[model samples]
Target: MLSAVSRALLGALMLSVAAVAAQAQDFPNRPITIVLPYPPGASTEQVARMIQPVMQERLKQPVVIENKPGGNGSIGTLAVARSAPDGHTILLTTNALMTIVPHVQTMPFDPLKDFVPLTTAIRGILGIAVNPNVPAKNVAEFVAYAKANPKKVHFGTAGIGSPQHMAGLLLNREAGIDLVHVPYKGGGPAVNDAMGGHIQAVIATVSSVIGQHKSGLLRIIGIGEKERFAGQPDIQAIAETVPGFEATSWLAFYAPAGTPKAAVDVLNRELVFALNTPEVKQKLFDLGLPVVADKPEELDRRTRSDLKLWGDIAREMNVRAE
Candidate 1:
């Protein structure tokens, strides 16, 4: 019933509409890959697996996790920043990789310009744990002991610019005590030394000491989180005695710059849903992490605020990469 020219025009418009609809519908046709800057078997990798299933269920596509660890997480982080802006790839990393690394090292990519945040994955508190042989039983006791002993109270950390190191510096500044800082290659080594009584204390994630603490091999003196963890109700918060002292580590999901808004939105919605699941929550809790599932704008704001805060901390302490 239509002439050739009219039919051609109608066909072109229909095709355009169909193309847009198809793009929207076929959003996750392929598997999605989440790149982590930490090695396998670490807390970050463990948490990634815990949530991957829930994300897959919500998105109806397989979510794969990749480990590309090195250079204090700078190597894999730069890889993610250079990745395609498509929704297929995502970076699951700690704030240290973005916020602390730039201040510590000469980076290959810009954190602010190279990526857009999708959502905050989790925030974990660091606990001050010590060998059971140490005399301190609480934060105040530890401060008093350290102050009395001075540099005799040796502490270990993952590395110089690591969150562990920053936490130690903050503790020194707040408690007005001088303690020797012994930097190790990673948390594993630092924790091992502490377990062997080679180190007096170490500021580390709760997950890193849950087993040892349960076995009485180590003592958790205080937590950085506002409230006590359900499993460790007996331990008091460091802030209770330190007065205004707190340090927490955060992990987030990010997409490379120029990623489509529709794609970012789709991923963000799925992540929020995935994090809200009971199974995901329990898994994170088991690892001593709390899910944050923030909106994109909220994540953006948090990132900027963290940058400013850490910048101040770095300047105040004169922390430099080694």
Candidate 2:
């Protein structure tokens, strides 16, 4: 016993709910695209490619990887942020986009509000490597050398305000050193300069310089992770010397903010399943990225925490992208 208008409103609401449920059931009816906000050879891109097949199989749709590198990862990230909130287009990017860049540069979208956290796909530790000519074999010796030399020691990073740059800033504050930062176009150039002895030190990912370290071209002075990386147990964690030093870079999956909760849940389930597969885990581990199939809330918490951490560091260091 309801008025005509009230009955019509109820019917319309029911229809809307049914439509959303149907859409969720047929989630990803079209091919899904994962936008990598960095160049192709980056660790994020590599990890995306590795997970692509498994995700496709799980979702029953082709998963495409699209690279759109520019503006320190903001260009492509903004594209994903502006995409339809239908789960068809998603972003697979690093913490730098949400945690570091926004603090240093003006972004088109709000990092916290424009996207929904899906999962943290993988995490990799940074390495404190030095040119072989430097007389530092450990974190203590390296810190001592840097302190003794002051601004004479140059530390090369991927770019200004990058995670590597933040790591350098943290190192200076925690270890009490005055090493100068030399910004490079990317980690490749920075690593190359360190290898060629153009720079005394470089903070880079383990995958970027592990081969060189093994070949004796460069020496890994310390690991920037709280615990030792499983792939390289012999390398000691920098925290042992610096007392609570830990900096890591991670790649995470996110969808547009208004994507249906059902769609988000499906994507998270498929992604977590893919990450837990033995072969996928093995491949990621081989590449120095440990699989971290954390729940959505976990990633969200981490992202928010890192945003504050890097924001404070940026203000203190007066870091801005060049």
Candidate 3:
């Protein structure tokens, strides 16, 4: 009972739906690669390696992890953003790259618009640690020492506009101290310098410096959390002394925008399932990454929220990347 043109439109719509369904069913015809936008041994890389095995088993495809570190994680992220939307290339990176860096540096792609968030792999607690030679036992002592020395206290971070950098900036604002920030290529190098006394202190993820702290090479003075993190209870919260100080970082999975919804669902399901497993959770915890397997929407919301938060912080502190 329909006109010829109307009938043809209906048929075309049905065919499009069928094609998408077929694409979903035939997804992952080839291997999938997770692009890690950070150097090896970073928390993001470590988290990706932890989930790679389980995800491979679930998807029944050979999963490969590729490390492409640069531009504060934008280099590899741009690669994934420009990749085909066939779900073969996934990006595993931190909030800083998506939320913080864009505000400071010109990005090749829109983070929120160019990528579909799959899931948040884990959240890490940031902490402030001092070299053994520095005279600081806790947040209060460190603040006093920094104030007394002024620019003499240098704090190393992963890089400019990184969560570590933001944490140091916030500490300066709240504690009224002047700790010069020394940006490094990555957290590993910063921690190494802190241990070697090349820098007086470092604001980094707890996991990145925990080993050195345990070995007595670097002394962790304060945890950048509202309360003491359950993972490391012995460390006192920086907020306890500074009042309302907190900073944390998260790593997440993302695929190029326009990837099939079916593929996104599958990846999210497998990732959430793998992270919920006790073995995987414990392993992540061992590396100072607490499991935070949330739905894709949750990651999206967090990304948007953090973008604003870091943007404001960067603007207030006049922090920019060149």
The numbered model that scores best in lDDT is 2
lDDT by residue for model 3 (113-187), tens: 999999998888899999999978888889888889998899999889889999999889989998899999778
How many steric clashes between backbone atoms does each model show?
Answer: 0, 0, 0
Error of 2 at 183 (Å): 0.2
Sorted on lDDT, highest at the top, how do the candidates line up?
2, 3, 1
- Candidate 3 achieves a global lDDT of 0.89
Q: What would the per-residue lDDT of candidate 1 be over residues 1-322, giving only the tens digit for each residue?
A: 9999999999999999787668756887789999988888876787688878888887888999999998778788888888877778889888887787677767788878999989998887789899999988888889989989988998998888777788888888888998889999888898999999999998888888888988998999998877777857888988899888888788899998877778889999988888878988877877888788999999999889878877788889777887
- Give the lowest summed-lDDT range of ten residues in model 2: 42-51
Q: Give the per-residue lDDT of model 2 (tens digit) for 1-322.
A: 9999999999999999999999999998999999988888878787787788988887789999999998778789999999999999999988888899888888888878999999999987799899999999999999999889999999899888788889999999999999999998889999999999999999998888899999999999888889888799988899999999989988999999999999999899988998888998998898788899999999999999999999999999898876
CA-lDDT, candidates in order: 0.85, 0.90, 0.89
Candidate 1 residue 265 C-alpha distance from true site, Å: 1.6
Give the CA lDDT, 0 to 100, for residue 291 in model 2: 94
What candidate 2 gets wrong by more than 4 Å, as runs, is: none
